[model samples]
Target chain A: MKSVEPIFNDGFAGQPPAKRALGYIEDQKKNGKHVVGIYCGYAPVELMIALDLTPAVLCAFSNATIETAEATLPANLCPLIKSSYGFIEKDACPFYWAAEAVIAETTCDGKKKMFELIASRKPLHVMDLPQLCDEPEALDNWTTMIKKLKGFLEKTFEVQADDEAIEQAIRENNQKNRLVMEMLDHSALENPVLGWAEMLDIVFYATPGRGKLINDTLEKGVKVLQARVQNGYVHGRKGAPRILITGCPTAGDAAKVFKIIEEAGGVIVALDSCTGMKPFSEMIAENTGDPLRAIAQRYLKIPCACMTPNTRRLFELDRMIAKYRPDAVIDIVLQACHGYHVESFKVGKHIGERHHLPFLKIVTDYSPGDIGQLTTRIEGLIESIER
Target chain B: MSRSAGIDIGSRTIKLIVIDNGEVVVRKKRPSTYNPMGLCDYLLEGVSYDTIVATGYGRHLFKNYRKGEVITELKAFAVGAAHIAPSCGTVLDIGGQDTKAITIDPKGGVERFEMNDKCAAGTGRFLEIMAAALGFRYEEFAQEARLASRAEPINNMCTVFAESEVISLVTQGVPRSEIALGIHKSIVSRAINILKRVSTGRTLMFAGGVALNSCVAGLLREELGVEVIIPDDPQLVGALGCALHGQRS
Candidate 1:
């Protein structure tokens, strides 16, 4: 068994786990195996599994500087690009420097520009998938993108991704994704099988190429959690208002907000975050024989708040609300996150008018120390919900 | 007396204010669209000024308008805040698309400024998103936010994740007022952080569309432990600054 090494920004909340993933990946590379770097929420882990390559999801560098990023990208571009440019500028990650190939998608304007800029700097094959809200055309576009990505992967990895190999990868990935979904479903049960923090860690681990291993760990963890739930070992005694959280990457202060809610007796039933559900919920199409098409389909359909000029996002929210039946909604939009803020208000109003549910909007930065005020707010919210 | 006009072409709206003898006699706001020239002409109908100064996101795009003197939004904001509140030293301007913390000298000269131009977390746009999510018009967001009794700190930096978190809270039946307060507090914290990054002085003034939200301003006061000075018309600070720039230039 090859070890995986997870290398990421130290500022990321779950640095220990990210390091573990990086260690595993490093071990695999030591065995002369090729490592693939997947940027953002687009890489199909299942396809990576099928290709027998180690998948390393690249996150933005925390210490990125404007001076470093300005060498390759325009100053007016999104910070995500500047961060990526900073990574190349600093030569921080070996995976970025030594990867066999890099993969990305046109998920949003920032990501689209990121793909273009990164490709210009390095040799990368990008998949321009249609906007997920477009439905029929989105599926067709996604399928084509997947086929092209598969060809690129085959050429880059020099692996014979024959029909058998592709099918096998799809099946494994489907099972892995199903297990993950099942785990999330289990955690959201009347008596949750997993703790909120543990569930978040599970999502993070499942993201990189270590989905298979993480699924195995979670399977065991779920068994233990199920027994505990059956035995009534849950911490909170009072019935809490079930809730869902939506926001961008919960890197810094954002994660603290979740802790505040759970402490205030609000059970997080679902999450719609750039770093959490959006990356994991992307499932490969079942019928698509081409792996790249499967990847593109997953990327387009994954619900993201960053999709500008995308109205169909409301329908996605409606579905999640129905599934979770949350008593209320909270929007944790950061100060400068324009896309999510726009969607947050729109969705908050939609849920209020249509579902007749209460809506809460909270804005935050990347720090956990601000949880004191947050706790009071969540406690008050729970009390109001009870009333 | 010489006549001059200052126009702010923002991502969401266009603001035009005409100044004569250091007084703003005419002010107009129009939705920003594809044609910058057309919008400028429509707003400036029947008005002729000697000099025009352009600022904001789309300021550089208007080439035909008066060979205008262009100034960054930061400088324009300081000029505007100084005119409205001469005693204010720290200016916090939360616009439609971005948020900035500008520290000014006693004379209203910009000492230093920190801006969040990359993301949409603490801007007017974030409030608009929350308003839309709650089924309220963009105009009513500040009022709704004012109704908040307590603010639950939302922990996500990305707007997308934060919206989901907000939806989850609504589904759980959190009170509208508390949620509103929480949103305001979050934005205040972000603005405060930006202020800390640049320079922390005294007499912080809140400007831009977000300045219209007293709850947000109140939260800023609470977080920064300073009194926030909100002018009579917070939205016009940028244009007022531009008009003032016309007089000074």
Candidate 2:
């Protein structure tokens, strides 16, 4: 389990390993190995790994300077798309130069056009996945899509993926999934070995094909953490409320919500967010006879804030609440996120009315300094819960 | 005498309103440009003001005011709607670029609000795009829509696709007004979807630039099955909200 260097280097030549890696990908292509790049979050990373092709996930560029995205996209487009457009205009993304084919799912209307626009720019193949809100239909559509994708890969790579290769890939991916899930479980232990923030850093770094190394490090850290907790070194004082946080990135102001809860004696028992649990959830179902259906089923169940019409979020919340037995539920909705903000309130009200549970709502942006007010609010919420 | 000013720098237009002792002394709207400070200065050329509050997409970019408070358009709309129609419980503002439905408490506080910030399906920008496609000015487009006897809504959600659908309707010898009405109805339907997501109940007050378009408003009211209230000058609602913020502070 060795950690690979970060994907992007200052310049192509500055990092010899990364440059050599890119060259290796090019050589692989010359040797008839297909190269595919998948967009971040909800991508079938394991399936792609099983395919034996180099799979790089697309993350929005860190530095963006362009302001006017209205010319290309509608003014009302989501910030993520706007920012990604800005990144493209600025030529900041390294993926623009490397990958032979790119794929994006139709998660939102903004992302739909993002795929179309990127495809229009160059002769890139785009996979239009149906919105997963339609339950069985969505699962069926996704399975059909994966089979079509596998066919495309076979044709593009000019390699025959026999049953053995597919099965072996699925086995390797399942093992990887088990390790990642185990790491997540160990990381969640009360007063566990690793610091949450440090673990998140590892998660971000590991996303670019370093999962095994991260799992190993986390496995060791978890052992130490478990011993400390058993020795009562991680105990909190008398009356802290147990809680669960659901959000993205878990950095900046959003992460501050968790800090406030912890300070108020609330231990975050479990989380159901892409930045938390969704990244390494249950593996692509191993036992299903049809691998594509298994992959689709596994993805449809992944926790996403953007779940629409047939979203199982309410069910997920109920399950998390029962498992964690938290005093209250706090839903952090980021500004300009129409999907999450709308869903958060509905879920909050449902949880309050049906389950007789208390719900707290926190609206936030990217600033971490706003935690002072947030802390006060959480403390008040904790007081109310205690009463 | 304490004089306050509220400037709303929207994506398409910049609006300024000077309020002195709860009276709106001046109200003006101008095209929003690269420099919002310049636009504000032009609008407030001879006007003297005390506290200034700005809200909208470009609110944070303007730095010419003495004391400025930047608030989201949602909060600003709530404050503005409550000031004019005290009985209004829900505020539905469709701006040039975005649409929002805000449910207000009886005491004029925002209980909950939902906004359409991801697409142009129900926005004034969508109308403008439709109008441009039909070879008519935005003002004429709504009037022509009024003349429509019946509307057959084009159901595609994507703006690019919807625009093409409108062109096909034109090609098939459908009357312009009917197509325009259909476009308006489509916009209303999209808006209603969002309103349904976060609505408390019927009592909705419609504001923002799109509220002035009678055809869109009419379709929206018909679709929601609720009487929609439009302010005297709906475009200035965000600026008016900023002015009201000044009054409260």
User: What is the iRMS for every candidate structure?
Assistant: 17.0, 9.8
DockQ scores for all the models shown?
A: 0.02, 0.03
- Residue B50 Cα positional deviation in candidate 1, in Å, after optimal superposition: 69
Instruction: Write model 1 residue lDDT over B1-249, tens digit each, in one string.
Output: 888788887766788989898777898987778887789889989988988887776665664554887666777788889888888998888888778777776656666555663456778878878777767776776677777666667776567877888888889998766676677777877888888865665888888878877678766777777777888877777777777877876
Q: What is the C-alpha lDDT of each candidate?
A: 0.68, 0.66
The count of backbone overlaps in candidate 1 is 83
Model 2: per-residue Cα lDDT over B1-249, one tens digit each: 588888888877899998998899999999878877778778889988888888877665663354587666776787898888888888888887777777765545555555553455668888889999999898899899888899867887577888899899999999888988888888888778778866736678989989989888887777777767899999998898888877777
Identify the candidate with maximal TM-score.
2
lDDT string for model 2 (A152-205, tens) is 766666656654556666666665556545544543454533334433433443
Name the runs in model 2 displaced over 4 angstroms.
Answer: A1-199, A205-275, A279-316, A319-387, B63-67
| Clash pairs, model 2 backbone | A193-A225
Query: In terms of DockQ, which candidate is strongest?
Result: 2
TM-score of 2: 0.56
